[model samples]
Target: MEIKTKKFKRDLLNWYKNNKRDYSWRETNDPWKILLLETISQQTQLDRADTYFKLFIKEFPNPETMASSSLKKVLILWSGLGYNNRAKRLYESSKILCETGFDELYPNFEVLPGVGPYTNNAILSFAYHKKVITRDVNVDRVFSRYFGVDEVKTFIHNNKKTLLDRVSSRDLNQAIMDFGSMVCKSKNPLCSSCVLENNCKKYIVKIKRPQEAFSGSNRELRGDLLKLLLSNNKLSLKKIEKALAVDREKLLKATTTLEKDGLITIKKNNLVEINS
Candidate 1:
């Protein structure tokens, strides 16, 4: 069944008008805030992201503020967020934004650290109000099911012009994401209450995969090492192993990975510290 683009869009927009999620970031057109929110949301749940967003905004309200701040300070604020590299990249990107400014960086946002295709489009659509789709996994799932197409990218490539016509890109993207999360969930979708139920060409039911255990994982070990380092200035390799209660080999591997990620550094005499 062919998607009735006009009716589908109208129905989706109408649903969004009433069902859209309220977020503090949604109230502003500030690109910096949107970029920060988007970057933080990449690895965090929305509720937690909101909390961190508030913290970050309060600490570094603008690119200039973040640019001038130390990476150590940013990482300290980003302690519980887990993905320390994002904070690093965000810090680097802020420096560039401060040096060049967003107006000069407009449409070429990918030049900023960690700003990929999805993020670039997100900043454009949400901040600049450009008519471009932010094709994240949620949007992909919604469109793939609605159009009954396995290859969503191909479909979007063929129909992107029609998709963007006469629609607010920001609202449409947000609505689809919300609808995907709330109604067309990956597991246990609420098909009965879906606004596009009749028009949806396929109803894909995905099995919910069990989350991998974080305990005893390398990720946990890395977090432990970083947390310890965050509290103190530095620790020796032997101390880290003893503190983490892991063997020397495992500690070395974790430290090596952390160093490679630019999260920490191991100096002479095997002293480990958060990368400055």
Candidate 2:
């Protein structure tokens, strides 16, 4: 069955108007703030990222502030967020943006430290209100399932421009994001409650969540080690191993990875500290 684009757009926008979440980042049109939120959100869960986003904005409210702050300071605040490298890249991006104007930034958005395809489109539509598609995982899922089309981009590429004046790209993109997150979730979607259920052909496919166990995983050990280091200036290797209660070889491997990632440093005394 062919998707009724007009009806879909109407239902999506109407549903979004009634059901959209009040995320703090969504309340404003500040490009820097939106960029910060999206970068943090890439590596952090939305719920936890919400608290961090508020704290982050309060600390570094704008590009100038973020650009001035040290990478160590940014990482300190970004401690539990995981993927600490993203924090570094975001800091670097801010510095670059502060030096270059926003007008100049968009043209080079793709090459920016953290601004990839989805982010570039996000900035274009959300910040500049350009009529472009922001096809992230959520938007992709919503469109794919509703239209029963595996490649949602093809449809958007062909039809998005024609529908732009009728349905603003920002509204359309934001609606799909919310719809996917709330109703057409990755696991056990609320198909009955979804706005598009009546018209949707239900191209639902089960996705497998990663089975990486945290007990002895490198990520777990690294997190444990960082938490220990965050408390004191440094911890001896023995102390970290004892505190984490992880295998010697696994702990060693995790520490090596963290060291290479620049998250930590080994001192002459064999004490590990947060990298300066």
Candidate 3:
């Protein structure tokens, strides 16, 4: 389960080279657009993220444009992207970058709001061609199954030299992501079609998990509520409750939590609006 063999690397990289999808984000080295793609893509799916990326990039284009825009306008544009909090975070990060500059922003990962370890590695590896190993949930799943080891981060950290020696870090990381998404998916993985079929340990071991439903989840409620507010600057508590169509208690909980998170705010008169 260690993925220590050179053949495994060769097969995965080769498969990726031949089968990877041509995403617009993959074609650029622009740090601003790269940051926008990564941040917007955090919780959104691939197709939807790309759609939003096209729309958002068309409107904002770069850090300066985004930084200059108001948070409410940004959230209005970002309405359907869900996790609307990211829009605000992206705007804040853009302001910081515009002031400090991308040259400073790229090197100091900590300065960027909402940019975590995976995103940091992605920015460095893809945008700067740095030899950093980027592992998101997809890459982690692929490594766990292929290597037959559960400690993905540990495995990658320990085996970086061997894993990355034969390929460019950007290509290798991109290959892992593409392979995971296309072949080694969470459910019903296309093992027969996978190039790594001969090398994957999980193909023999067989691991599975249940998919979580999104309906009525806190995230769904929050997103719905945000959408309602995004279209209409503020809404009366009664109006929001009626618009959400969820149980009163659940709606209240979502709104209160959103207020605490600074994604929304409630006036004394009970009108809710996106936080300034």
Candidate 4:
């Protein structure tokens, strides 16, 4: 029996081969570099991330070197890129991977903290050309609209392998990522221009709402705080709470979120940056 996802995979792959962006990660085979780009791009856009990625390579050329680095330098380089924790996690992951005692690049994502499935596949596809499925917000929307998935976490964590097993992970990841960026965008979805429109869940369901359903997001706030502290160098919890104008709990939540995400380190004197 033919699999139920054949048409979905076919349409997506066809669309992908014909209409894809010339992204920076596509040009390299370095796992460490791919990992860096993946880390920097978390909750951040590609345009902003590309700039830092280049700078990151210049600053920390190797895994072992980056593992032995400091957060002030990382935060300085991370600069405009937000969710500073991503940079911290990148640094920590580098250290973790380095501690494994392998001299070359560490491509495995399962053991890497601060890394999710999306990032794992990014390294595999862009760095190793391995068939991997990627699902950022874009891919998730593509999944939600097409596969009757309204809950983001469900599809990413539970239903991903089910859908992706029918397609090449690399192609599926690339396809949906491009589909979201180019055709299935936030405001106006170019449905007519999209190749997978026929099989698109959103198109089939006749729904037009973007992933705005997943709004009230913490990304922008996190970015703002990181940039502020990186520039100002040590902000009191009170100072940050006032400047941001958020409730104490919200501010505290953001801080904890960032810390857990590996963006900053707290000490007796101040909240210090751990990644750039």
Instruction: Give me the runs in candidate 1 sitting further than 4 Å from their true place.
Output: 1-3, 203-212
The digit string of per-residue lDDT tens for model 1 on 1-276 reads 224776778899999999989999986789999899999998577889999999999999999998888998998998888878799999999999878988898999999999999989988998899998889877888888888887888887788777888888988888888888888887677888888899887746445477667888788888888889988869998888888799988888888999998888899989998877
Deviating ranges (above 4 Å) for candidate 4:
1-4, 101-108, 128-130, 147-168, 201-276
Q: Between candidates 2 and 4, name the one with more favorable TM-score.
A: 2
**Which regions in candidate 2 have their CA more than 4 angstroms from the true location?**
1-3, 209-211, 267-269
**Candidate 3 residue-wise lDDT at 208:** 47
Which scores greater on lDDT, model 2 or model 4? 2
Q: Model 1: which ten-residue window has the lowest total lDDT?
A: 203-212
* Minimal lDDT window, size 10, model 3: 203-212
Q: Per-residue CA lDDT of candidate 4, range 1-276, in tens?
A: 124356667777787787877766666777788788878877677877778888999889877878778777777787776556666777778787776732333455756867777777787776666655665767767776666567756645654455566455666776778778787786577877766666656633345455432233576677777877777766777777778777777676677777777565555665544344
TM-score per candidate, chains pooled:
0.94, 0.89, 0.91, 0.68
Tens-digit lDDT string for candidate 3 (157-183) = 888878888578888888888887888
Window of ten residues with lowest summed lDDT in model 2: 159-168
Comparing candidate 3 with candidate 4, which one achieves the higher lDDT?
3
Q: By TM-score, highest first, what's the ranking?
A: 1, 3, 2, 4
Quote the RMSD, in angstroms, for model 1: 1.7
Better of 1 and 2 by TM-score: 1
